[model samples]
Target: MITSAGPEEGKSTTAANLAVVFAQQEKRVLLVDADLRKPTVHYTFNLANNLGLTTVLTKQRTLKESLRHTGIEDLSVLTSGPIPPNPAELIGSKAMKQFLQEAKEQFDIVIFDTPPTLAVTDAQILANLCEGILLVMYSAKSGIDEVNKAKELLLKANGKLLGAVLNHKKAQKEDYYYYGG
Candidate 1:
């Protein structure tokens, strides 16, 4: 999953929340902090940034060395290790591609928290990598023009654009419920 917006848009929070939902369903999920340019998944989860995905990508460390066990049982995380100078080059490299391939085989779902598409090429570079990209939008914050630009980037990448996830849904009408039981 590629969680991003222009900027200051709570992309990481959305991604982390999704991980929580998946874990609640008993799925073995691994969160990959692919946003090397500005990584915050680790911080969101309150995990260490000592070592992670960058280590695996740069081949300075192995996958076993980088994959850290979060407090959540079914969920693990690979943080963006030691922010590198060439984050775009690294993520768009052959090694990152190879790592993702192997990761799919190991975990049920691998969620990638990447940079905002409009802010940098990092998300666009990563959009090409994942099976699906989820465009996150903030209520009353994101404009149609910015979204359209992102859509264009998505088109150029040949990404499997899953759909948009509308966050911060404010209730305009009174909350209603139907009994299923």
Candidate 2:
């Protein structure tokens, strides 16, 4: 699962990139937009969001029926269907666990793009289900305290922190210089 301390910190981008990378390596990858409140995976992949995670969870559609092919070999996406009034409840539902089990059995890698930890409880609810959580922090934009708080929240939810990724870091001139033999 990929999330951040706050919004606009590149969580979705990281999840999408990771899925693509795994797919390139010949692994079957499924990138799920678990951010029910504000989904962006459909937009990122240029896929229709008419039916997706929500539809599957509600039993309105099967997982296979809701999955959207990304046109990239071994890569599929399950976008957040529609904005629901109770996202947190839906995420913590038993159906969600069943969905995860089914997805894991089908894909080599199941990456979820979740909402920010501080912004909603959706990510925290999902933390317990996912094997690990990757927190994406915006360089120079995210405060140390906010990151720590996000970490604390995930840990409290029994989530295994898989370390963090620093995004949007401006490169300095010295960064371009490399030592070579």
Candidate 3:
């Protein structure tokens, strides 16, 4: 799952780009719009939003029926359907877990774009279900206290704390960005 402490931190963009990169490597990738409250995957991919994760989770549609090809080799997307009144409950339901497991079995990588951790409990709920989380934070916009709080919330939810991606970091003349273990 990809999320941030607050909105406009590029979580959705990161998830979409990651999925694309994984697909470019010849891996089957599924980019899921799990941010039920405010989904953008449909817009990002120019796909129909009538049926998707929420539809599958609510048993209104089959998973296969909800998935839409992104015109990218080895890549597919499952946009969040109509926004529900109780997004957290829908996301944390047992049905959601089953959907994720099925998706994992069908794809080499399943990346989810979730809401901001501090904005709602939706991200925390998803974090526990996902293998790990990539917290995106704009270097110039995010504060240490917010990051710390987000980490603490993840810890409380037993979410795997994957290393964060510091986005929009101002690069210096001699500086370079490197990401690896």
Candidate 4:
């Protein structure tokens, strides 16, 4: 699953929460911080990003070396290591392609926290790599115009859009669930 929307729309937070939800369901999930230009998945989880996706792509570190076990048993993360000068090029490069191939084999379900589709080609490119895309929208922040624009771009790229997620939703009593990890 590739989670994205416009900038600062809480993609990282949504991704983290999704991981938590998946964990609650007793599923092994790996979250890949693919937004190399401005990655926040690590920061949201309070993890270091000194060596992650960039390192793996530059060959300075292999995927295994960069993958961090989030300590949330059943969940792991791969941050965007060392911001690259050419983030778009790197994300669309052969290196990232190979990495996703290996990731698919390593994890039960891989979640890519991607850059906004409108801002860069990163999300569109990543949409191709992941099994499905989950576009996140902030209630007051993301306007219908922006959401529609993003939807058009993803659709043009043939992204497997699972659906749009409305974040910051007020949860009623029915929203709560309990399960051991």
Output the number of the lDDT-best candidate: 2
lDDT of 4 by residue, 121-165 (tens): 888877766678889988778889989888888878778888988
Name the TM-score of candidate 1: 0.93
Q: Best by TM-score, which number? A: 2
Candidate 1: residue 35 lDDT (0-100): 84
Off by over 4 Å in 4: 170-181
Question: Residue by residue across 92-140, what tens digits does model 3's lDDT show?
Answer: 9999989988998999999999999999999999989999999999998
- Which structure is stronger by TM-score: 2 or 3? 2
Higher-ranked by TM-score: 2 or 4 = 2
RMSD of each: 1.9, 1.2, 2.8, 3.9
TM-score per candidate: 0.93, 0.97, 0.95, 0.88
Worst 10 residues of 4 by lDDT: 172-181
Among all windows of 10 consecutive residues in model 1, the one with the lowest summed lDDT is 172-181
Q: Which candidate, 1 or 2, has the higher lDDT?
A: 2
Q: Per-residue error at 37 for model 4, in Å?
A: 1.7
Candidate 2 lDDT over residue span 1-181, tens digit each? 9999999999999999999999999999999999998899999999999999999999999999999998899999999997788899999999999999999999999999999999999999999999999999999999999999999999999999999999999987777776421
Model 2, 59: alpha-carbon shift in Å?
0.2
Error of model 4, residue 5, in angstroms? 3.7
Residue 150 shift from truth in candidate 3, angstroms: 0.4
- What does candidate 1 score in Cα RMSD to the true structure? 1.9
**1-181: candidate 1 lDDT, tens digit per residue:** 6655687676788788888789779998988888887889888888888799989999999888889888888888999999999988998899988899888888898898888888888888888888898998887888889988997898698878898977776855444433332
